[model samples]
Target: MAKRAFDQASQNQPTDEARDAYLEASRAGQSQPPETEAPAAPEVEGQETSEALQKQPTEAEDDQQKLQLEPEKDQTEQQQKLQEETDKEHPEAEGETAAPEEPETEPVDFSILKNGTVNKGGNVVNEDGKAVGRVTEGILKHLIGKKVDEKGNIWSTDGKIVGKAEPVSESERDELLKEPAPFESFPDAVVDKDGFVVSNGEQVGKVIQGDLAILRGKSVDPDGDILDKAGNVVGKAVRWEPEPEPEPEPEVPVDKSILAGKRVNKAGNVVDGSGVIFGRVVEGDVKRMVGRMCDKNGNILSESGDILGKAELVPEGEREGLKEGPFAELEGCTVAKDGTVVTPAGDIVGRVIKGDAKILFGRAVDEDGDILDKNGNVLGKAERWEPEAVERKKNPMSGRKVNREGNVVDEDGNIIGKLTSGDLQKCSGKEIDDDGDVVDYKGNVVGHCSLIEDIPKVEEESPEDKEKREQAEQDKKLAIQMSVCIEQCLDKIRPICKMITEKIDKAERTPEDERDEEALVREVKPLIEEGGRILSEAKGIIKGLDPDGRIAANAKHKSAAREATPEEHHLADVLKDLTGDVTQCIDNAKRKLEDMPHAKKELNPLWGLLNEPLFQILAAVGLLLAGVLNLVGRLLAGLGLGGLVDGLLGTLGISRVLEGLGLGSFTKSLKGGKKKGGGLLGGVLGG
Candidate 1:
């Protein structure tokens, strides 16, 4: 097998020298026939000596001799020695010789391996001069400190064959350089940098260090070839065999009979025949029955086994109502077996009596005992049943009494059978009077009642007193009519005064040359006349109300006015003030209108000339100069040099020059002079 591997590896050799060396090694390995058992010495009568057996060549000595001599001579010498030993040991069988049994050689694939040479230092190096690994196995111990050729053939100092170097590769060299993974069995095994299994720099092998030692400088290829750094085949990777999976335990079938006659309670617990909770069904189709008191037959029942509904009878969303039995049918309300109506919060709201329901609170109830909505409309009703009597009380609003049956009663102690509208009536079918008395057809008081207060009697007045009263009423009527007229006058005066004020303000805001004095007068004249007319009319009405002027005279006297009634004095004073304001507003409007014509005459003709385009351009230039000088003046003022600006303006005499041109105000602003006038042109024209 070693020869076969060498032959295959030689085919891939890069150089002829390497190939020849591989072939020579293969031939050398092939020259030695496998060691076999020496032929048993024939029986010899006189050769019973132990010395001859001891002197006979052992297998190791024979192998060494074969390597030193030619192959044919070695075989011939070995046969002659065996014959001599057989004759000495057993003379009777001297002519008979037993053939040797060939030894078995373990097969190794050398194609995946590379040659490594052993140097004088006892370390192995591959063809690239890189360290492969040291051989420390006892079988190849003689090769230590001996020279090995490129073909891995090891020779002694005398040129005798010993053993071959193990194979190594570049790929294994890289793997050895990695941080070693922890291995429990090879705690002491470590790889050196040169890819040798070492213990503190001393070479080791599998025989001394166990199987883990072989992995120290080797790596398992993907194909499971264990290789050393120099491409030598070291060992094979042991395939990991997983522990067999435990045989699945056979499934124990559920009897399912245990669930017979079971039911799911409102809490989702599965109850058995006696309603004792067995276990809970957490999921699956059975989970839909959670919070539903349903039996296995799908009958939704109460805790007492009353069938309120069936699971299939109601939609899935409405099934929760089954838990409460019949009571859940009524939304927001519930009814007791005794006909006591209650809200879902268990508050008693009404009662069902004799198939008629009555709600004591603000809510209304129908004949079927269901509470009605805000508009007294019933949504649905509960089952009707006769209930026990509930006490009756009088209606609070009417203060009328009620019978034991909750019907209204009149003053005659007659049952009115629940007043549906208005108050109760008499037994005669006549409406009761507001004074709580019942009268006959002729208007005679037939019944004297105390259900409400009695009506008071009114006395008749004397003729003389009536006359004074009528006269006083006539005076009050006249006063109110005069007051109304006064209000109308003031209402008219208000708009006139507002018109005059607005026109005057508009004229004041207008530029003198632009003001239309005639238009202002025309607009204000009518407003002032209207205001004067209103004031005159209002004063006449006031005089008519107080024909002697006594009310006005009394109002002027503060002490006398205090002694008089406040209403009388206050009305007189309001009318007096109204007349005064109307007159003042008229006089002010006339004065303002009268002054407009004169003010219009005083406007400078140059102000009108300023409106011309040439004059406007000159004004713009003057305005620009004013703005620049104004900025300079402000800067000088901020720097505490304001006096300098004043002096500069005085020296320039710009103000005097502008004054001659009717632009004195413009230059004054640049000189930081007092701010006055409507604007640039308004100040120049002195309007």
Candidate 2:
């Protein structure tokens, strides 16, 4: 006795083996059912004995099966008519009928037959319902002991012809499958569960809707070669191949002498080496961008504006003035003594107006306050303190001029007073000669100056003048060092950047345990802090030159960096590459660290499903395979092959397999997964 395990579905449906066994008796040349049937002997230990293994069909499947029968009834009638007409001319169809009409009657119960047979009206199926000849007495006599030939012709084993072959096409397969797609080539084609095609009483080749390649009674597979009943190769199909990927471009080398950097504002725009906006984040979950970002034409950014990157566009029109102008260069320059502004280029452009950041434009001016151009032509009016007033403040002895007679006179030559010995002693211009006598501007002896005649002959300085002179020297040194200060700041950021880059690269290659994320942050933090300190110092040094911070620079950087010296402008780009790169690198390191735990957590459940070492290895391999399939699925989508691939996946049940592997979403995502809020979730999944 054969024992069998029956599941819920199996309990409702008989297996194809049971049905095929019933067909076996008919194929065994049984003419009629025996009077007393013997019980079937089941000796095979592992062999299936029940027909319940065959999946039960729903009402829709039932309709499809009925559909196969409906077409054949009409086809059989047409063929019988054709045979009847042929019989009128040929002896070969002599026995075929253009039979007279008979009274309508109920179906004949072939009580002699044991099990049963699949029938369409009066016709019967020989190839498991993909019939080649009818079961009617007339046709049975002709088909008895016959087999389907290589050409699908029903012929006696002794070589007598019985029936014609049918050609299996797409329509035949569509009829076989329950949920068939719309294709209208065949008008009356039919197929059984065994991949056999039958139209009327003629047998046909196998058909498959999914694989598009038939293996006799085997299931469809598109990538497989077409094989006959004996597994002989009969035909081939051209497999789909995705487009070849383009080779990656090489990276450009940078000059070692200059440290490069960028600044990404809160808006996710990238500033490059020249304060020009290089690119902007246009897409993704960048909802936190501080402001709307635009390009040269004022077009909005379209890329997913990551917090750090370089902008790719240079703006047009007056915007150019923002980037390359004399005033722009003066940004980050140094202030000199004598009220002159010393740019980093080592040129004096103008004087800083007292008590304000205003520049004098260096126009020539008269003592009485008249502005003049280089040609000495009056260009404009200027305001200044009168010479006399300035002189009065400079000296307390502001009154009289002395004549040759040593008499002091006022305006109009009126004699106001006579020069006294004390007045002569107080005279600034009067100096005691080597002979110790007081002399006037004309070397005339003004008086025999009393004691303390040795006035030390040393020029004394005012506190204010001394301070101004010292400030001038400091300014001169600073003007020369502006570039150096900025370069130093960027240099500090560079090593940190390199370390972060190296860390990210290493993380990609090694497992999480092997990653030195802590070391990366440790190395990068101080460098960033130090970079920040250097930037602040550099900005302070250049503040006077860039009062508004468009140029000479600051820690609060933007994309407007420029240099006073045209040749050294690249150096003055203080906020150019450094700021964005430093922050971006730091963020990248942090992101990698953050992502690791989540990735492991998401994958851990899958790992938990496996315990044995072999199973673990298999799980790993499965993940790898899933990764590969996901990649291939993406490539296929890129090539515009969505429908074919999706259909194939469904057919081969690879889609279900992927779902079982926890990559279900990945495989099905191609159809409708475009906009996923395009934000945090998008970034997370993409990463």
Candidate 3:
């Protein structure tokens, strides 16, 4: 009976060995929760007594039954063990292996699905949230049998499309993990904590923390604080400021007036602050305008102008005598209040004298302010008349003379002389001829004139005149020759003198450290000697001449000799004057040269040659002629032709030539001759 019951229980268990093992396991652990419901066994009607099956007596029967039970129990335990082992080995079949990987959950973003089906908006996303066409095996395999929408979309708690519910690369999976956890800590409301935010009902795609948004050109900061990358608050967006504008430069004022008291520069434009202008004032333009101020002809005069200064005019009629006396005075020369009274004739600058009166054709008035004669006779009044010159007259017969008023006369009624009558009274000459007859104004013999032939005839030449004339001519020729020599000398010597002078100047100008005194001296020594010799020679020549020289030759002698012809006298005078000038020049040169250092030191052998007795004798001959020339020069200068001396000085090599010879002192002395050369030797020696 027990064996039948056990067989029945086992049969009522599952055909699946695993289910049956579970039932047995359930039964074995009472501490465990009830794993299976209790089973109900159907009751069976028994009619029997098979003594063989029921009886328990014999040892063989007991042993046989025990063997049968052991085999059956062993079979059942083996089947149950195999079943449990299979369940563990194949947990998927048991509905327990990792729960099908949970479909590789993504953030629950329903926007990736369209209601119950996937739509265009439900496009799948890669693990990085970049939109993709569909879920790949690489992504799907990770979510093997997990629940997924029909479109294979997966969702996560954060409502974001983190990844698709499919097999994805391990790298993709890692990328998904790195994404920020959803902002779900807050809420799904469109408005954020700071202000309003518009989010799609679906997913809010990648939202970076710092990017700015704008609406209607105005920057919007939904996060309110709008923190920068460094987490510092930045203000809302604003319009940019325009670049700073550049400044403009000021303008310069222009001057419009041409003669606005300013001078125009070479560029022809007027500048401010310059002094006034004085226009061209050439001779003959306007004499008074010489020093006066004027603007350009057409321009307006300056406010300060009335013509700046007074002008002195030299009229055309006065030009001829301009070189003499008051006329010769400079245009602006001023006369002293005391006056220039000392003249060649006498000091007549302020003296007054009365003279016999006659009126030829002039308006005249008498001493009493009436027109009358001393005899109480009425003289005719005149608008114009000639005035008479006063004179003293004598009667040759009585030795008596009458005064200018005809008051004093010889008592002789013999008619010695009569005072002529006119608007003014005057006296006529009383003459007595050899016959004791006086000649009247008509050439008639009114009275006898005495010894008229006894007077000298100034037109005839005298013996003394003849001699002086010849000498003057000789003097003049000598002067000409001397002048030629001087000129030639100056021409030859000027350049060399300039060179020497420049060299000396250079040496003097050089710094002390750079100076070479010995070299400079040696170089100049010979030149100095040459100049000295020339000067000494010239001096020697001058000394041989007479004291006054040709310049003092007797003009009377020359004039007398020339009485035969006027032209001859003029020529002789000129020649004599020229000779005197040459003589003086030679002396000047000599004195200047001898005084030079080189000549004094006697360093030049050439100087000895110049000093030779023969040369001296020859020079002596020239001196004799030079003396004559000197006299001639004086005569010529007195005759208004003295410039010959200047010509000679310039021509003479003496002074200028000496310059090259290192005779600067000698040159200076020669130049000084103008003041000292009153006499031949005086000029030379003084120089």
Candidate 3 residues lying further than 4 Å off, grouped into runs, are: 1-460, 508-622, 626-687
Number of the candidate with higher lDDT, 1 or 2: 1
lDDT winner between candidates 2 and 3 = 2
TM-score of each: 0.27, 0.16, 0.19
**Best of the two (1, 2) by TM-score:** 1
What is the C-alpha lDDT profile of model 1 across 215-271, one tens digit per residue? 655544444445678987665443333366999999875344444455676655556
Highest-scoring model, TM-score: 1
| Residue 108 lDDT in candidate 1 | 34
lDDT of 1 at 372: 60
Candidates ranked by TM-score, best first? 1, 3, 2
Lowest summed lDDT across 10 adjacent residues in model 1 is found at 46-55
Model 2 over residues 134-193: C-alpha lDDT tens digits?
Answer: 221113323444444333334555665443322222232233333432222223434435
Report residue 544 deviation for candidate 1 (angstroms).
6.0
Clashes of each: 14, 29, 63
